[model samples]
Each structure stands twice: as C-alpha cells, then as structure tokens.
Target: MRPSSILSGLSCAAFAILPCAAITVDLTSEDSIKSAASTIANGMMKFYSGNVTGGIPGLLPGPYYWWEAGAMFGSLIDYWYYTGDTSYNDVTTQALLFQVGDKDNYMPSNQSKSLGNDDQAFWGMAAMSAAELKFPNPPSDQPQWLALAQAVFNSQALRWDPSTCGGGLRWQIFTFNNGYDYKNTISNGAFFNIAARLAAYTGNQTYAEWAEKTFEWTRAVGLMSDDYYFYDGSDDTINCTELNHIQWSYNAGVFLLGAATMWNVTQSDLWRERTLGIWNATHVFFTSQGGQAAGQIMFEVACEPNNNCNVDQLSFKAYLSRWMAASTKVAPWLYDDIKPYLAASAQAAALSCSGGDDGTTCGTRWWNNGVWDGATGVGQQMSALEVIQSNLIDRVQGPVSNSTGGTSQGNPNAGSGGDSNPIAMPAAIETSDRAGAGIVTALILVALVGGAWWMIA
Candidate 1:
C-alpha cells in the first residue's frame, strides 16, 4: 500500500475502533507533516506581516511592548529554524532592531528600569535566538543583542536569593525594596532557557550553573500535590499562596522547553529527569489522563463546539502548540500527543474569517460574542500557528536527538563537568515526589504511549 493511503487507512480504522468522542489524527509521515507545518507557517507569516504593514492596526502600535516583541521575535526564529526561510530571519532582524533602537541607546533606560523579570526573561529568549543566529559571526559588529541578554541575566542572577522559600531567580526588582521580591515559575524557567542558550553560545559556566540551580529550585518548591501541575511557588504566605494556586499552560511549557534546552547543552541526568518530569506533566494536563477532562472538553467545545469552537481556543492552544513544537525537538513522542490538537486548531483557524490580505482569521473574544479583534489576539493566533507549523516540520524531519542528555555541548561549565549548580535544599521533602513519579509512570504505561508506537507507526 502507498504510505499516505496506509496512514489514512490506519487513521480511519483507529477512529472506528476507539470509543472516545474525539480521535487525534496522526500526520507522522514526513511529507504530510511538513505540509501541515507549511500551512501553519504561511498563516503565521501572513498575520505577522499584516501586523507590521498596518494591515492590522493597533496590533502592535509603536514603542512596542517588550514581551509582545519578544513573542514575535521568538516566533520568527521558530519559523526560521523549522522552515529555514530567510524571510523569517529578515523579519526577526527588523523586529529586534526596532525594539532595541540604536546601538548607543539600545533597550530604553527607562524601559529597563520598569521592566519585570518575566519581561526580561521573555526578551532574553528573543535575544538568545538572535545571538545564536549571529554569534561568533554576527552580520554586523554591534554587540547590542549579546550585551542586552547578558545584562538581563546578570541583573537577575545577582538578585537570586536562597532566603526565599524557593531558590530560583526572582520575578522582578522592586523599587522600594532593596532585596529580590517574588519569584514565579515562568520567570525562573525563562532564565534557565536563556542561561542554557547563553552557555551553548558563549561557553559560559556561569550561565550553565544558574540554569541548573534554577531547575533544581523548581523541582523542590514548585512541584504541587497533583505532581503533574507545578505551582508557581509555595503556599505558606498570602502572596505566595495566591501565586502558587494555579497551574498555567505557559509555565509548564516554558519549563519543559528550558529543561530540554539545558539537557541539550549539559547532558546532566538531573536535567534529563527534569525534562522527562515536565514532559510527563504537560502530557497529563493536555491529554485525557491529566484530570483536565473538563478543560479538554471545554477546549474542544470552545474551539469547535461540535467542531465549531473558534479562535478563542486558539489563544490557549497557542501555548500548548508552541510547547509541543519545542518538546518535539527533544522528544518526538510528544508530537503524537499534540497531533489531534493541532488538526482541530488548524481546522478552526481555517474556518474563521479575517479581512486581512492573507484571508487569515482573527482570534475570538468569548466575552464579546465571538468578536474578532486584531491586537494580542492576532498575535496569539500567529504564535499557535507557528508552533503547529514547526511541529509538523519537525515530524517530517524525524527525530534528531542530542547526544548529551543535560551536559553542555560546546562548553562544559567550568569545574562542574557541564552540570548545573544545585540550589539550597528544599525546606522539607515534599510527599509529592514519589506520587508525581508514579502518576507520570502511569500516564506512559500504555504500549501506544511508548517508543514502540512511534516505531510501529
């Protein structure tokens, strides 16, 4: 049988046999996966280009917000990485230059003073991408990109404190307070990602050490009762309690991607364990078994209620899609889990209408009776679309595993053998470790969820 026909036949048979209301489509083959990825990329590029050219006004009106700019820059790099399209790179360069301004006045001083740690972390992600593309041989002599990343890292790293319940990087610098303040999972995870990337590019052990310590802190303090869901912080105090209560999609996504990056750079068993733990956590939340049955049902209903949910779901799915794209770079098995979600999301996006040049759709606003706006909503749509594209391409390219599990690839951390430094010990050994591990093990217990399924398929 022809490969495509065989896949189609298998899909039909699986749907017929499966009892679940929703069946995920597996576009595991190279060509089909790439085609899907291309579709996503085209959609994302169109949306981004539109925003840039006043096609979508107010989407990003002047003096761009750093985080929003970071997201756009990240998406562009992602597009370039998966598709190898120079246009995306060109867009990234333009975006970065626009945000940083000129060399003498790069990254506004006032903006820098008011910047939150999460904002810096997000920008770090974008800067790292730019640095990677230009490092050791940048197109120009300007060091603004590298300097900005390093300054952000240094500023945050200097503020890290063990006195805090968790020993990860702090969330921001307080104007009134002299010490580091609140620390969130996203902030810490972003630093880990940035540090790992910096270590890879510059052979800096300081960056590697910081990344490892940050990951360890997350495992110690952030692992919640569910094991699958990581809390942002400890719930001892009121502020901490408030922050620690909810488990967000992006927090897990950023942490997993960071862990994977750390493992790529530093082949440490700890980082590998962290990566696997995060992957398991993400799979639990996103898939059926994660106790998010209502969420899953809601996502399906909201995106295409009876296959009709629109762009609102795309906003949420963007986080998952991007995470899955990054995860697939390290763990191809994840692509299987995300396949169905991607198809559903793409189907909904294709159906929704936008008045833009590409005929791409705008994101949905649930509160406004499914109204479509052209601001952050469009950005969210483009982000998700980019992830869908990247993952599909990755699926087509097949798996390219990094030999080093968590050790640095180019530069091992000095005196650490490429291992990240450990954080201060957890206040008390939480009971959730073993339980979390058990839950993770249970989620992957099925034969279809293992490597065997990928091989057979």
Candidate 2:
C-alpha cells in the first residue's frame, strides 16, 4: 500500500472504499455494527410515512422545517458514505429532491417563516457532502448536487449585507422576523463552510477568497471570539454596537468545519490555528456526562439540563459530531489525540439505546451508562448516528510514508499544542495536489475485510 492510499479512496456503492488498515476502532460485535448503521436508515423513517402512507420523508411528524430535515438527511448521507449501503443513499436523494423548491435549491417557504440564511446553509452543507463524496446524480431539470450547493452559495452572496458590519450576513432574509439587524455567527460560518468546500472541490480561487472574507468578517466583529469560542451574534438591537457572547455547540461546529475546509483548500496556518482553537474550545466547554467528565463526552451546554432545546436546537449536536469527524483531515496533527474522545462518545451513545424487538431509541444524555435519559427524536438519532460514524472512520493502519504537499499554514493563537505559529500558503504548491480528485477510480487494493456489515478493530 502506498502513502497516498490513505486519503485516496473510490466509491464502492455510495461510499469511498477506504483501506481497512487506516481504520482504528474495532467493530467486532455484529449487533453493535447493525444497530449503529440501521438506526440511520430505519430511524429516519420514524418521522413520516411514504407516498402511499401519506407523509413527507424529510418533515417531522408536524412543524416541518428545512433545517431539521436537512440535518437528518445530512447524517443519512454520511451514513451511506460510511457504510457504503445504497439503501441509505437512495432515501437521502429522494428526501432532498422533495425539499428542493422549484428554483432547484432549497426554498421551502416565502412568508414570515420563510428560509433564513442559516436554514439554507444547512442544505448547502449537505449538497457539498454529496458533491465531495460523489453521490449519484439527480434528475436532469434539477441541479446536480454540486450545482445545487452552488445555488445556495449564489443566493447567500446576494444576501451578503456589507453596509452593517463591513462584510457579515444577517440572520434572516425575511425582514418580518425582526432579526435582520443581527449579524450572526451561524449564518456567516455556514456560508464560510459552503464556500470553502466549493473551493476545495473545484479549485476555484473565487470561492477561496469568499471563504477568507467570511472568516475575516466573522472574526472582525468578534463573533468568533479571540478565544475561538463563537458568540451568538452581533447586537443588532443597538445598531450593531455591542456583542452577545452566547455560545452554541453548532456555532463553534460550523466554524470548525469551515476552518477545516479552508485548511483543506489553502492549507493555511490561519485555518489550522482557527480550527484548533475552536475545536479545543468546543471540547472543553461542551462535554461531560453525569458527575464526572468521563472520557471527554459532548453535551449541549445551553439546554441539556432544563431541556430548553428547540426543534432546531436538538439537531445542533449532529453538525458538531459530523464536522468534528470531518476535521480529522484538517488537523492531522491532532488526529491521533482526537480518536479516543470520538470512540468514548460513540460507546456511551451505543449503550443509550433502549427498546424491545421492534427497534431502539438513542437518547441525548450519553453519560447515564446504559440509561436512556433524554427524549428520543430525530435529533437524538442524528447525534447517535454521527458519533458512531465518526468512530467507524478507521484511518490509522494505512501505509505510512514520507510525503508532504500542503503549504505551512498555521494559526497565530494556536494554544492547544503551544508551538503553532502564523504561516502563509506557498505559491509553488499545485492546486491539483491540494484538491485530490473526488472520485478515486476504484483500485481498492486493500479491503477492510469484513465489509461494513461486520468489521474488527
């Protein structure tokens, strides 16, 4: 096996055929593997019945919203990618097609509760996942998955309001929401993620510039605090004069993944520093189960105890889970150090499943030690699915060799390791080398042996 084989993988069914030696965690148990994966395709069905059954696939039982559905489908897409089961992929495409409005992008509503910038951004992230992972194409009239994401990027660019905060987007596109004044981290971070990903997939300098602009604006307004902890938004009630320092797991997560994507595109130390700072802040502030910390567990610090997590709030952890897993490539310097925490969370979540022969419901509170404490919902299932999938990403045993290509991009305030400093992208580095081909052309020389159905550590 060659060194490049570790990051290079081809689609088998719908997933990249990763070399098994790269895998770290052991999934020796047949039942654990089944539960972890089936929960994705099956649990998603819990929301609505099909055409004959009289319900939509993406919507919740009631209160249908684009953001939540986008999240559920996002995790499902990842499930197919991780497990290589087309069954997961089929439903994901079907659901996305249902939600994409006549414009070929997501525009579920147009009135007072119409799509917000953040809402649209979630679907954009999913489309990027589809494009980057090489998911199957959609209908001819509809946008290709990559183009679908680009539509969102296009729309968001139009909404980018430079008048207020120099270069940040507002929270809502609809003026009726009374939130137009607020310049938010989620909206900007979401845009940053989409732009950074598109830049990586296409090697477009334009997207990279937008990615950097979004990051700079986000930082300039103090939304992504000097500490790298993301605040709620800029104080629009006072004409953008003040700052609100409320942090959410998803806010930090959106930035982390965006920074990671930027790191992928430019390999800049700024992105690396930003990635490390936000990641470390996320783990430190949003963790622990029960009385003790116990293996770096993650929790929704804002609404875990009182249970104030709204429908939108419920799925925030899912982004954190998936993005943290995706961040493995950006900060490979911390990849080895990060695996145990992912494994610990997944193990706790797996133990949270409780039910009869019918099915199992994964809970929110993972620290209960086999106790299902939180109410089961689509968000809960998404959280469990993402965590399990993260651990399932085996990247350790692949062939190791002396090879390096990225420029020495670093962060000014990278504190976790202490030594990271600022650096610029090298001019000689080839974009082809930075952005590897989306499709690896099979050549799956080393198989994980047991397939996703069953696997060993």
Best by TM-score: 2
State which candidate has the highest lDDT: 2
- Which window of 10 residues has the lowest lDDT sum in candidate 1? 1-10
lDDT accuracy of residue 300 in candidate 2: 72
lDDT of 1 by residue, 1-457 (tens): 0000000011111343322121112344445434544554555554454345454321243333445556656666655555555655655665555554232213344455445667656666666555554422224544455555665565566556555453455555555532235566667777777676666556666677777666655655534333446654432232232333434456677777667767766777866766777766664333332232222211321122222222222333455556556655555455566556555443333323232333333333212122223322444445445544544544334222122322212212221222353222224323442222222211111121111111000
* Model 2 worst lDDT window (10 residues): 1-10
Q: How large is the C-alpha RMSD of every model relative to the true structure?
A: 12.5, 16.0
Query: How far in Å is the alpha carbon of 108 misplaced in model 1?
Result: 2.5
Please write out the lDDT profile of model 2 over residues 306-398, one tens digit for every residue. Answer: 445555556677788888877775556657756777777766666655432233666666665455553556777788778877765563221
TM-score for candidate 1: 0.62
Every candidate's lDDT: 0.47, 0.62
How much is 28 displaced in model 1, in angstroms? Answer: 7.5
